[model samples]
Target: MPGERIEGYATDPSALIERLFQQVAERSMVGLPFYRPQLPIKACAFQLLEGQLFGALLTPWMLQLMLLPGPGQRWDYRRADERLALAFPQGEILFRPGEIAPDLYYLSCSLLSPVDPALSAERAVALAENSVRLALSLPVRQTSVINTGRRALLRGALSANKG
Candidate 1:
């Protein structure tokens, strides 16, 4: 089976990285302290790693924004937090604190995508939650499939004696 490749396996390393990034976000957001409202978070920022790489080699900066309904008023994009202003261009409109349309309460997530051809759809949200969490120094739980050294050594010794 040398050189045999499995279908659906990402030949492109970028895709693997992207998938890992998404895993980080998915794991981080579940039962997350800031995730209670389930604000729409999106991947909107991208840093190019290489040019003309198959499927585009890019790293995305994932972000989420919360749009709290304005205090008895319509949404106002112009008044959104200045720090979040650059994340989403439409967010300037979608996340405005006022009413969505005078009666609806809604929020929007703006994202920087690594490979999303269509930018606005929720399906395009890239998973970079881990990068964000790491950058912010947020605590993360780690999991592994490999056995511990003690167990591995014991297993190796047992197999050697058996032979």
Candidate 2:
């Protein structure tokens, strides 16, 4: 949740997509696909969490620009299966669609585990990179809808809980 902003990239959407994929491919192990509906603001962000977890924050348009299908559709993590599971090393990755907004989603990979102290930081970085790739490559379908305000409040509550 807390990370340094990835810098030195152009703001253009096309350029961002290229750079994002490149970064993820270089640093991660599996590439996973993800989907969501459109949102008011469009952006893509990457964060290195405590040097052990890598996170990618992508908007709906970003997914579309990446040539992935299903913008303006629904996504459900419950439907994800073993094939998706294999993309992540140590099976510690997470795919969380927004509960309130329903338009935002995150793919995160954990590098270090308190319970498994033997996990290496290098392995964690690779898994995180693979997650970004897998997110762009996977297929997702539209499912349901929720109010934007409700989504925002839900996100805020979740953030508060993390804090």
Best-fitting candidate, scored by TM-score: 2
Off by over 4 Å in 1: 1-78, 81-98, 105-107, 112-115, 118-163
TM-score of each: 0.21, 0.21
lDDT of 1 by residue, 63-158 (tens): 433233222333334333433332321123233322223222223344332234333333333334333232234345688867769988899999
Give all candidates' CA lDDT scores.
Answer: 0.35, 0.34
Q: List the residue pairs that clash in candidate 1.
A: 42-111, 43-111, 43-112, 44-111, 44-112, 45-112, 74-98, 74-99, 75-98, 75-99
Residue 44 lDDT (model 1): 30
Give lDDT for model 2: 0.34
Model 2, residue 121: distance off in Å is 1.0
- The TM-score between candidate 2 and the true structure equals 0.21
Quick one: best lDDT, which candidate?
1
Error of 1 at 82 (Å): 5.6
Error in Å for residue 106 of model 1? 4.2
